[model samples]
Target: MRPIVVLLTVLSTLIFPGRAEAATTFGPREAGVNAWPYHDGGQLPKKYTGVVDNQGVRMFVHPGITGGRKMNHPVAQAQYGLALVNNYRRTHDSWYLDLAQRQARRLADTHVDARGAWYFPYRFDFPLSSGIGLTMRAPWYSAMAQGQATSLFIRLAKATGSAEWRRAADRAFRSLQLGYAAGVPWATHRDAAGRLWLEEYPGPNPATSARVLNGHIFAIYGVWDYWNVTRSPAAAAIFSEATRTVYTYLLRGFRNPSWASSYSLRGDVPSEKYHNIHVNQLLHLHALSGQPVFAAMAEILHGDFTMARVTATIRFSGGTHVGVAFRSTTDGRVRARRGLTLGRASSAPVDQRRRIGGQPGFWYHVTKGALAGFWVQEFPGRRSTTGPIATFPYLTRRTAVLAKGSHLVYRASGPSVARVSATSEAGIVRLGWVDGRRAVLVSAGSLRGLWLVVTPRTTFRIAEGDDHDEVICGVSCERVAPLG
Candidate 1:
């Protein structure tokens, strides 16, 4: 009977392989746009108009700071720039490209030092403090920011034929590479052995400790990008060494087969539970690197350290810090219980938990009464109460439509979120309400032979495709309906 069930599952996947094609969209919906109640510039209530100057060059919504100045940290600046570059690639809008260029210039002028090694202010609040000063030259900074900047500049140079951008990217990569000492990159010069170090001293020491995993992972990611852009054998070798070293340490120091534990190199027992978004990014890196052990570790972390079960409490007044815990569950559903506090840090914890149900994915507070986003699909099977899921949230006024056919296009007026199922078998897609409007389309594929249902409330329309054999429907929800 078990073998029969397995065979049926395999046959279903083969007949309807939804995994072949990439999703129409990827990444978190609320990314770049500030969902928090903070005053970040780009996250303002206004419509996103391609990172305007008035909106500021930095993507973070914080006021008073403009251009890359708004982003004191090299990592933050790189992430913001990367987001802009990605947006430009998707939309082909020159504004995003221009914004990335401006930020890159600012980074080159302000962050890159006389030593040709790029370093950034560790924190926006700390001016010329020692902690900040030391981190400015940290190898972790180079590892995270340089590759992103290089990738962005390379793309920009090609797009606009700007030699300056190309040169700047080359300089940045060379500077970052120069920061490495011996096989192990120093987390801080304040220490010998070139071990990992943390900038936020007296709080949590990340250097020379196993906690270097976070920085190590970022370093690997940057090296990967460097290899992609330059195709340099040196970059490839660096990537390989970094991956091997981190994996060796992670497995030896953190792995606990019994608990399926893969901690943040903190070595403490409960510290393993705190592994949030970093674990996911590492999993992605492992998958990209083609390392079986890293990939296997990723799976274990995902299965055991479920983020859905965890809840966060954040106080962003002075600076951001959060505590996380796995939500206690009774029957398979998360109980509406208070979240456990995991402590705080400088920034919001990364949201790494896979989605479940037809709900969107997020790590912060969800406005319960307010309609935000909904979940659409789960991969590998029709649906598992527990598994990897995708969600689409329409935060703006624009409406979206997911056509019915196997080959369907989901659309949004501006930047919208669409969740594609991980697998094609019994895949489901969802859209959030936009002033009470909805639309749906259908396609004719083998997967269509199975009965598929889409429920839309408020206003809707049906568009016939080719013949009667193909039909699509559109719906709108104004009065508010429960999304499950």
Candidate 2:
């Protein structure tokens, strides 16, 4: 009990008890507030914990589709590796050390070397539900796995001085530096704001990725781990830039004063399991960086551990309207009955959020329905005193009735949001939405992936080429002019 309290205090202060060595007390935090300990499956001869021998190597297993039984998991194996390394650090156990090596050997043995940078592939079908680049086939890999594997490799290299581990780390760390623009992109996503984010699930395109918070943070730890070991200037620069990116979107898009934090930029409130992980991860960052805001956010999130029951409210300041987007504000946290234009208020502020759905929809305070007192998605953005609200206008230029097996092009009449898109043919490509400045480059426009047309919907134009399938509907909710 005494040791636990002492450990917590030291971790909170970001003070490593043994600072004489390079980075011995550092990896991902496996104790205190932010513990990411992957359970070391019990004694081996006949028994194991959450682990299964996949072919020959020991891999962590989860009850995915196979209820109660275990299936091989990507993150789980990496996490277990980390846990083994952590155990080695704590108890100085040679067995833990050997297990860590075996764990990493599988990763080193089977990593896909794209050019020089390496990626560990997930070879099974996983459900993907984000914007763009999704065909019938699931995307190959994830940035989270990339980051986790990198961290494990770095730690193994530093601990055992294995040249193999160092080489593996070298390849895996380069994966972090690759951008989303590559022919076979790694994980780094350059946002509309020109900031780089390590995406957890970078669907098929960066247009509407699952800009997940925990995944980015986890990746940040890996980057920082690499930097901590090598002291490379480029690694240090990436670490700084990525941390800044997290700060940029933290409050603006991720936080909700009323509800739980968003899992990604696009996802709604997360489940209890993920929500707890989020809280702990934030605290871990706060401890590592000595940042006050991260700690503050952690404190706030701790209080929000339980769900609050919401009953109907009789009066709301904003009048009732369906499909109107109302971005919540600091000042507008309360309800006033003066009746503003359904979310347009002088007191409350609004922020223009990013989405591919092509219209601003936000958390508007609902008052007069069965779901009253809930912050509905259709409350604000009608008249945003803040920024450009999303508009989904059914755009119509000169529509060409191409033949059943013909491709046509239609230039947008004005600045508009592309609402829906369909394949011109069964396996042919759809017309690219070009707006002079930026074009949404998609890999596949399959019906399975609605190619969820995300925002940053620039002004005026579509159909650069003559390759066309069927009718692509644009809910043109802006001033659009026909281009010849």
Candidate 3:
């Protein structure tokens, strides 16, 4: 019976590809977990500690599925490679390293086309299709998937000093940098403005030729990462040019201080969702480049109150220094209610006993929910907020603020309170505990700077870093009093 199911899965992957459901013959009971989320057979390997960074909390791979469901989504396959690398970094585990190499080879060999185009079916036929990039929203080979896969290959090459991976990375990089001959009229094209934009799909009018903000951002970030590691001149040129293109598009189209979920290459925002995806993406871009424009764009997109909508206010049992960060939309509407009782972060903030219940909604999890650890420590609800809010540097320590035309993105840690002082622009917000060195980047409106802080919630400390020298006033901070 098991062999039959496995055979079916392999056949489905080759034939239908993205339209097939995962095989459910493999059970979570074998993996020692009670009930699995998403794909049934998938499990967090027992050895995984779920600690942040240098290790993934969960593996979306399912034993019953061909390529363990990673092949179902292009980004997932690449991220799996990342997880493999991260696990190796933490445990010095040879198993993970070997698995990563094998995974990379399979993906490149099976999916990649002659023109370096990856046959990425962005939509999956799974139950949670609506929430994720299902419904066949975009084209087969999206910038997000290609860019991420390229980065994964490059990273693998750097890690193992393998020429095959490097060659693979180069091919994908070319397809991304220069539009591939997708072999169909509408497969790839350029907009009237003469800017190159990949076909999101081979169907329909608008969907056929378009660009997604997050997709472009992800690809650009991946290119940047590749350049950072290898310092390849070709990779660097592509990264620089792509960054400029995205920056220009964002400034012109997303200037309303809010954004539609995605926009076409012709600069038409198809539809708008009340979400923080744009904010998070911009924040990530800012983190990568430290460019004021990206920070400014983040400040604008931060007004989308999706983060507030996902937040469930839970009380802490012990005396832990906690803070709540809020973001509002352009219409002066705040999504967060002042005091709603929901779940709580563990007073023993260090304890990882309380796992979030069930899988978060696909869109929520990708845009904001995945980064919930950086905001809250833990909670019982599938969507809960209950920890130090480290969304932004300027207001990292604020308990609450009237989020009007402003968005807040933060990551917090530690149970005890500590006095942290940066430039004047960098407010005196009560941050959660810090195990070691954590650098904080603060930006409220035009004020932006990197500050000397302690370590990330869970990370190894590095050498000493420099501190900023300027000071400025606070914008919307709540807690001005110090903790006793």
Q: How far is 302's C-alpha from truth in model 3 (Å)?
A: 1.1
- Report the lDDT tens digits of candidate 1 across residue range 261-293: 443443334233335444455444434453323
Q: Across residues 85-170, which tens digit of lDDT does each residue of candidate 2 receive?
A: 77777667787777777778877776777868988766555554433233322336677888888888998998989898988888
Clashes of 2: 22
1 or 3, which is superior by TM-score?
3
> Which candidate should be chosen as best, given lDDT against the real structure?
2
Task: Give lDDT for model 3.
Answer: 0.41
Candidate achieving the largest TM-score? 2
Off by over 4 Å in 2: 1-47, 54-72, 129-139, 307-484
Per-residue lDDT of model 3, residues 1-484, tens digit only: 1223433432333233223212211100111111111112232252543222233322344454334453345666666666676666556778777766755765685564544444444433331121223234333456666777777788778778899888888776666655534342223334555444434332334334346555666676567666666677776566555554555565455433223334443345423442345655654554454343344344434322223332323333433332222242223232332222324533212212111112111111212221333323232222233443324432112112111232233334422233323212232322221221123343342323222233211111010121111111111111222110
TM-score between model 2 and native:
0.52
Regions of candidate 1 where Cα sits further than 4 Å from its true position: 1-55, 59-71, 121-142, 179-211, 255-276, 309-484
- For each candidate in turn, the TM-score is 0.47, 0.52, 0.50
lDDT of 1: 0.38
Candidates sorted by TM-score, best first:
2, 3, 1
